[model samples]
Target: MHVFLPDGKQLDLQQGATALDAARAIGPRLAQDALAATANGDLVDLMTPLPDGARITLITKKNPGEAAAVFRHSLGHVMSQAVGEFYRAKGHPADAVKRGVGPSIENGWYQDFDLPEPLREEDLPEIERIMREILSRNLDFSRREVSKAEALAQFGGDPYKAELIRELPDDEPITFYTQGDYTDLCRGPHFPRTGALPGAFKLMSTSGAYWRGNEKNPILQRIYGVAFATQKELDEYLHRLEEAKKRDHRKLGRELELFVIDPLVGKGLPMWLPNGTILREELTRFLREQQFARGYQGVVTPNIGNLELYKTSGHYQNYSDSNFSPITVDDEQYMLKPMNCPHHVRIYASKPRSYRDLPVRLAEFGTVYRYEQSGELNGLTRVRGFTQDDAHLFCRPDQLKAEFLNVLDLTVLVLRTFGMNDVRFRVGTRDPENTKYVGAEDNWNAAERQIIEAVEEVGLPYSIEPGDAAFYGPKLDFVVRDVLGREWQLGTIQVDYNLPERFDISYVGEDGADHRPIMIHRAPFGSLERFVGILIEHYGGDFPLWLAPRQVAIIPIADRHNEYAYALEAELRAAGLRTEVDDSSNRMNAKVRAAELSKIPVMLIVGDKEQEGRQVSVRERTPEGHKERKGVAFDDLKAELLERYRTRA
Candidate 1:
């Protein structure tokens, strides 16, 4: 057999050789350090036999993508074994603890367990100690294949493992990994030895989860742990976790009076408070102005539509799981619109168009509904109903590229305005083998090619992601990283030819013949609710002057200064500023503290000197040092505030 390296070097090996054998043949030092191997871009265990002519990239600890997952998954297995040992030391049977599925997640790993006795938070430290003791032994991980009946006989008393084996197909290989008398059924790509795992790992927390995420199944205790290649990396990650806790949107939302999700109303349904509504309205106005300047016309659509409309759009067949159930009234079925494109399609078809009317851009801040599961609901980020800054462009084939570039320009501008300038693009295309998509092969290829060309022309950084496209078309998703190094998919622009064809929408061409138009669907701010949630966390509740709900707060030193403060507020409001006066009986310093806690961008203090000079003391909130400008003219202050709002500073 022959194997190829990443650099195109080939090696001849024995017929039954594995990645470990190849690594040893390359060099002793390489074999000692190698954690796993990627055969033809697929990560595999070192012990797994390699096929002829396979391209192999030996993964080390420096390779975080595959190596980190392998290390973390091995850590999970070690933790589970430690749990069993701890139970046996306490005079319980070794088999007293039953294990469920355990897998490596983004930065850590977790395992589910059905214990004979309840586990508490204090038990974590003991489990860690046992894991370290086991690591000191430096045990080797050995893999073996067995028949389904033999595997069932070994774990038959443990219902969870037995049930899993029973569900596997007869032809599929049944594999198990064993290390120092502890074994588990897994499809593993793990480190060669237990000592290969680093000591920079810790148990985070525990939570209750149903078996396989089904509500009717028994609840199991899930333990989570995070690991890294070095102690420095672990410390840095822990610091970031602390920062994230302080900036949690749900906590800040309540403290800032932004929005509320009440179970009394319904789960996953959020209603914006007055302060949050101001944020929503300001964002809408900003985008609306930009769209208007870009030749997009505003259009309105109903919240519900006939079921037949979605059937024509192919959304009913692909997205019915996420959509709310249909409503039947007098033998006519209607659905709460899950998306705006289908409704917009009907609008384009309502009247006759021509090449002169080609590239008709229709825009709306449309609200949509989806029946998200109860467990998946979070703060505003995941909701049952939300509004999208949606638009659709109907254009000729020749105009498709220009229209796409225009939308891309608008999306970048919107993101930069919100201080989310660190952006990347992903061109999501259809999976070649998936039958779930509804479109011709040529149409999919054309749409995907156009998206790639647009991104390339703009010279933006992007990657191609297969199986991430919508059923009808290919899309370019804008992923932005925030202040805390967290990524959010905030905007999207999709190209479609299937919807127009399904609805048979066409326009008259210059030759007086009907021609099908291509549709470009876009939402610069993917959803108002989710965008606001990200913004809240990104800014840490301290919004910029232009987007702040309350632009100015006026505090009176005493009752005597109330009149002047109210007069100042009136003048500021007249100058197109959002202003508020603190008329409560609290002291001057207390009012200042309250305004600071609320994250008001500007604070004005009124007193005797200000009354005599007809001026106010202004203090601006900034991330850096704070300074006060004493005795500034009220007119100048109003002008400055208005200018900032106008320029979106």
Candidate 2:
């Protein structure tokens, strides 16, 4: 048998040789250093038998992407062992702890256990100590394949593991890795030894999760831990998690009075408060103005449509699970609009278009609904009801590139406006093997190629992510790095060839024949709700002057100055600045503190001296701190405020 290396060099070996054997054949040094191997891009343990003619890439600590995953899985095993030890020391039997699945996740790993006693938050530190002790012993991990009957018998007392073994195919080889005093069932790639793992892991927290995430199943205590190749990386990640907590949008949403999710209204349905509403409307107005300037005509669409309408567009078939169940209207089914493209398609087909109207760009702030699981709901980010800054353009093949570029430019502008200027592009192409994706291979290829060409023409960096495409088409996604160094997938522009064809929409070409027009779907904000949620976290609820709901606070120093403050508020309101007059019986300091707490960008203090002089003692919030200008004329202050709002400074 022969296996190929990444450089195309071949190594001849026994037919049943493992990756570790291949590594030894290559060199003793590689065999010693290799933590895991990737057989044709699939990560496998060194002990896993390699198929003849397989292409293998040995992973070491330097290969953080693969190495971290291997060690992370090993860490989960170590943690599981430690949990058993921690329990046994408390007089519980060895098999007292029932196990569930433990898998490596992004930046970490987690294992679920059905414990006789619930694991508390305080138990994490003690578990950490045990985990370190296990790692210190440097236990060698050895794997063995077992027959189905034997595997089932070994885990028969544990229903979770036994059920998993029973579900495996007859031909599937069941394997378990033993390290020190513990063994568990797992599909390989894990570290060769506990010492191979870096001292850069920490047990983060514990939570109750149902076995297999199904509500009807028994609950298990899931412990989450994050691992990295180096201590520095681990430290940095922990710091980011800390910063993330500080910037959590849910916390800020409540503190800033932005939005609320009332149970009576329904889970995942957030009603925007006055301040949140202002923020949303401002964004909508900004995007609308930009779209209008770019020849995009605004249109309104219904919140729900007939089920057949979605069936025609393929959303009903492709995305029915994510979408809400259809509502019955007059004994006919009506679906809450899961997407705005289908409605826009009908609008395009309503009018017979010619080559002269080659590019028909229709824009909408259309509200759409999805059936999000209750547990998956997170503030405004994951919601059942949200409005998308959605638009669809139907254009002739010749104009497709220009139209796509125009939408891309608009998306970039939106990102830039929000200080998410550190942008990266991801081109999501269809996965050929995925039956869920709809459309011809040729159309998918063409759509993908056009998006790639446009991104290249703009001279930006991008990556091609397979299986990230919309079911109907390939898409260009914008991943923006916010102020905290966390990346969010924000805006998207998809070039769709399937939907137009499915809808049978056509335009008269110059040759006097009808031709199917290419369709482009774009949403710079993605959704107003989610974008604002990110914005709330990105800005830490201190929005820019233009976007701030309460741009100015007018605080009268004393009761006698209330008239002046009210007049100033009216003036600022008339000038398009959002202002609130702090006219309560509270003292001037209390009023100022209240204004600051509300995150108003500006505070105007009026008193006898200012009222008599027709001026304001301005206190403006800046990154540097509160800046004060005494007795600035009302005209000058108004001009400065207006300029900042105009320029979005």
Candidate 3:
């Protein structure tokens, strides 16, 4: 047999040679460091046999990004072994602890266990100690293929493991890895030995998770641990975690009184308070102005639509999972609108159009509903009911690229305005093997090509992602990294020929014959709720002058200054600033403290001297510290603030 390396060099080997054998044949250093290997892009353990003519790439510690999964899986097994050992030292039976499953996740790994006693947080340190001891032993890992019957017999005392083995597909391989006296049922691509695992790992936390995420199944204690190739990386990740804790939107949402997800209102439905509503309105107003300038007409749609409408758009057939169950009224099934495009499509079809009105751009701040599982719901980021800054453009084939570029421009402007400048693009195309996608093969290809060409024309960098497309057509998704270096999928622009065809929508061509129009669906602010949540964390609640919920807070030092403070508030409000007067009976210092805590952009202090001087004491918040200017003329203050608001500084 001959196997190829990444560089296309071939090496003759004996039949059924494993990756470890190939590595040894290539070089001794590679063989010694080979943690795992990928045969034709599939990661596999060293013991797995390499197929003839397969392309093999051995992974080592130097390739941390790719090798993290291998070592992380080994860590999970080690953690589970340590747990069993810890319990055994306490004189429990060897089979007293039952393991469910442990898998490598992004940045870490987690293991679920059915323990003899509830594992407490305090026990983590001891578990870590045992894990270190085990790692010190340099136990070599060995894997073996087993029959379903043999696997079940080995784990018979552990019902979780037994249940898992029974559920395995007949064609799927049943394999187990053993290190020292501990063996686990897992199909693994793990580090070669315990000593090969990275020392930069920590047990972060634990929680109760229902077995396999099913509430009806028995609950298991889940322990989470994060690992890195080096201690520096681990330290950096830990720092980011701390920073993320401080920027948690849920906590700030409560303290800032921005939005509320009340239990009485049901889960995943967040009600925007006055402050949060202001944020939404300002964002909507900004986007609307941009759209208007670009010839987009605002349109309104209903919250619920006839099921037949979605059925016509292929959403009912292909995207029914996220959709709420239909409501039956008078023998007609109506669904909470899962998408705004279907309604917008009807609007375009309601009346005749021509090449003269080729690009009919319709925009809406449409509220949509999805039946997200309760456990999947988070604050505003993952909500059932949310508003999309959605729009659809129906244009001729020639105008498709131009219109897409226009949308791309708007999305970039919106993101940059919010200080999310670290942006990347992903062109999501259909997965050939996925049957869930609905559309003619030619239509999907055309739509995907149009998006790619438009993105290329703009000279923006992007990557192609398969299986990330919408059911109806291909899309371009924007991923932006926030201040904390966390990435979010924000804006999206999708090109679709399928929906227009499904809806039977067309426009008169230059020759006066009916021709199908291409649809460009875009939502720059994916959703108001999710965008606002990210914005909160990005800015740490210190919004800019234009977007701040309360831009100016006027503090009156004495009772006599109340009138002056009210007058200042009036003038600020008249100048299009969000202003408030703090005349509540609190002390002047307390008022200043309150303003600072609220993250207000500016605080104006008024007193007898300021009133007599026809000026105000200005204190403005900045990244460095508060900048204070005493006795600034009212006109000067107003002019300076208005300029900032106008530029959205």
Candidate 4:
């Protein structure tokens, strides 16, 4: 048998050879660096035996695939060893602590442990000391392939390990990784020695997480740590973290008075303040006008809908776990809707349609609720209840591709309007092995084909992500990158083949036959709350000229100029701009500072000279200085503001 190497070299080998064996056959140097293998496109361990013919890509430290997973999984074991040693050194038994699953995730890894006592922030330093000492030991590593019974015996005294071992499939290898005296039940291929791992590990935070992410499960202390290939990488990541903290929308929101999340009102609900509400309303108005111009009709839907509506849309079937519990009315049940598609579908079905009316776009600012975990709740990014700038397009099969491009164009316009030009697209398709998705294979294939053509014909830069699609359809997600370089999932466009079939939605074709109308569910701003949060951080709470809640704030220097300030405010308001006047006897400089702190785009000052001349002094919000007075004609200033508002930039 032969296997094609990454460099297109063919290596003749036995009919059944493992990746590890293949690596050893190549060279000793390659064997030392080999971590795992990518058979075709799937990630698999080196221990797994290969078939007769295959395309094999060897994974090493340079490849962040199977190698990274093995490395991080081994690191979790190291962490557990450190904790156990720390407890033993304190004359405490290891069995007193409860251990949970430790998995390697993006960036680094985290492990959950139910400690005898709560771990303090100060304890991380000591824990790091122990971890470094173990790393310095340079322990030799080995893997053991054993039976389920043998694996259970190896970890029986350790309840968590035993539980994990019990869950392993009978066909699986049931392997273990061990370094020195420390061992863990893990699937491999990890580095040959502990010394191979880079010495740039740091414990970042300690938080409570449920065991296996179930709220009913025991609460465990989840210690998150980040590791890098070099000290420079670690330092740069730490700096990014600091920058992220500085750009935290929750902190900036409070400081800028943009929005508020009060605990008394419960978690995950954001109450937009006066200034923040202005921002929300402005965004809604902009989107509404855009939809109106794009052949869309805006409709209003209730905050909650009957549970049956969700059942018909398959939300009850696919997303029941994430949705809020039903609001039962006697024998009947109602659910706080988790999505806007159902209501929009009802609106589409409310009227008769034909192939001539191929596409009908229904838009709404739909608010929905989810059952987010309390611990996962943040100010606005991860909220239980939020508004979505949602729209659903019901169109004939022939019109699907064109309608998709239209939605894509609208989404691009929405993002570009606010200067959010740094964004990437993810084309989410179904997982081949996942049976939970709702569509028939033919319909799914047709919808996915049209979407791929639409996105590609428009020349979009995107990656096709398997298993990331909504249960009902293949979708495209618009991901925004903020100032801090954090990616935020904002808008989404889904081509749903399942919902239309499930709801039995149809239209009269030109052939005088009843046929299914393909549904395209889209939300330019996936969640208005999350979008606003990302936008705040992206701009550092300094909104664009059009989106600024307080477009202009007028300040009167003295009682004599108060009338002039009022007059200036009226002039601005009459020009269709939002304006406010600070008539209090506060210092003019102080008023200006307040306006700047609130991130107001413009400030109008009225003093003795301005009041007499009937001209208001204008100071724009610029980085260099605040008192950058560039007095212009009041009418001219109005025209510039109107231009910015109209352009939405």
Which candidate leads in TM-score? Answer: 1
Whose TM-score is higher: candidate 2's or candidate 4's?
A: 2
**Local distance difference test, each candidate:** 0.92, 0.91, 0.92, 0.82
lDDT of 3 at 315: 80
Model 3 gets an lDDT of 0.92
Worst 10 residues of 2 by lDDT: 60-69
TM-score of each: 0.95, 0.91, 0.94, 0.86
The reply for model 3, stretches above 4 Å from the true place, is 5-9, 12-16, 26-34, 61-65, 167-173, 607-612
Over all chains combined, what TM-score does candidate 1 have? Answer: 0.95
Rank candidates by TM-score, best first. 1, 3, 2, 4
Given candidate 4, what's the lDDT at residue 603? 88
Model 4: per-residue Cα lDDT over 533-587, one tens digit each: 8888787776777887778998888888887778878878887888999987789
- Model 2 clashing residue pairs (backbone): none
- lDDT (tens digit, per residue) of candidate 3 on 367-408: 999989888899999999999999999999999989999999
lDDT agreement of model 1 with the native? 0.92
Better of 3 and 4 by lDDT: 3
lDDT of 4 at 211: 78
Better of 3 and 4 by TM-score: 3
Using alpha carbons, what is the TM-score of model 2? 0.91
